[model samples]
Target: MLRGLTTVSHFSDDVPAAVAWYAELLGIEPYFQREVQGKLAYVEFRLGDYQHELGILDRRFAPPGAGTPGGTMTYWAVDDVEATYQRLLDLGGTAQQSPTEHGPGFVTASVIDPFGNQLGVMFNQHYLDVFTGRPA
Candidate 1:
């Protein structure tokens, strides 16, 4: 059995600026900002009911051999993938993939944030039905 997601983390050169942009994108301000280990680092913000943390650290602090804009990507499921994708575009996000059907009643799209972080918008009526114990 899988537990619910706890948090998603992203690395940024400028923590404050990243937080602000994300806040605007998500329409929520950070709930916590604090320094860690003698350096200005880490901010956590809520998205819907989930928590996302962004870390600000020196280049050397990056994971071993992790290049800038590491290939890691995060997808956030939304009720309306197309609308969310367009809203992100209007908010200055770079579109990576226009909305398209992925499977039976499933649609998805993606965009790159100002900081080069890829954000995906997804919708799956089947998955929703399964999770809610309803017929698809």
Candidate 2:
């Protein structure tokens, strides 16, 4: 059985710094964290509809030779593509793709966070309408 996305996780060498950076970007603190013996192990932020989660894991868990801006990419919804794109860049996230409108109101952009993971942002009309009962 396959379930849809419940969480999206990113890796970072520094948990606290990654937490701070993501908190600033998302404008909210993580709602849950995994810690063992009082040491940070993981942090998760719930955002968007379905409480879709974005998690930050300590990079120690990554396989050897892993690097930032990895192969996988996941796009989160954003209301304003241009402003959000600029904001991520301003926050030290390197640009991977500038915002581009695909077709019929679907737009997207991507960036590599300071920690080297790809972060995607999209203004997806269909997804927004289905979730919110209003067109994007």
| CA lDDT of each prediction against the hidden true structure | 0.70, 0.88
Q: Which residue pairs show backbone clashes in model 1?
A: none
RMSD of each: 3.9, 2.7
> On residues 92-121, what C-alpha lDDT tens digit does candidate 2 reach at each position?
999999999999779999999999889999
**Model 1 RMSD, rounded to 1 decimal:** 3.9
**Runs with alpha carbons beyond 4 Å of true place in candidate 1:** 1-4, 36-40, 49-61, 65-72, 130-136
Candidate 2 has its poorest 10 consecutive residues by lDDT at: 62-71
Best candidate according to TM-score: 2
lDDT per residue, candidate 1, 1-136, as tens digits?
8776666666566766777777887787777777767664777776642344434333335666443444765667688888899999998889899999977878888887766666777887865676688445
TM-score of each: 0.75, 0.89
Off by over 4 Å in 2: 63-67, 134-136
| Candidate 2 accuracy as lDDT | 0.88
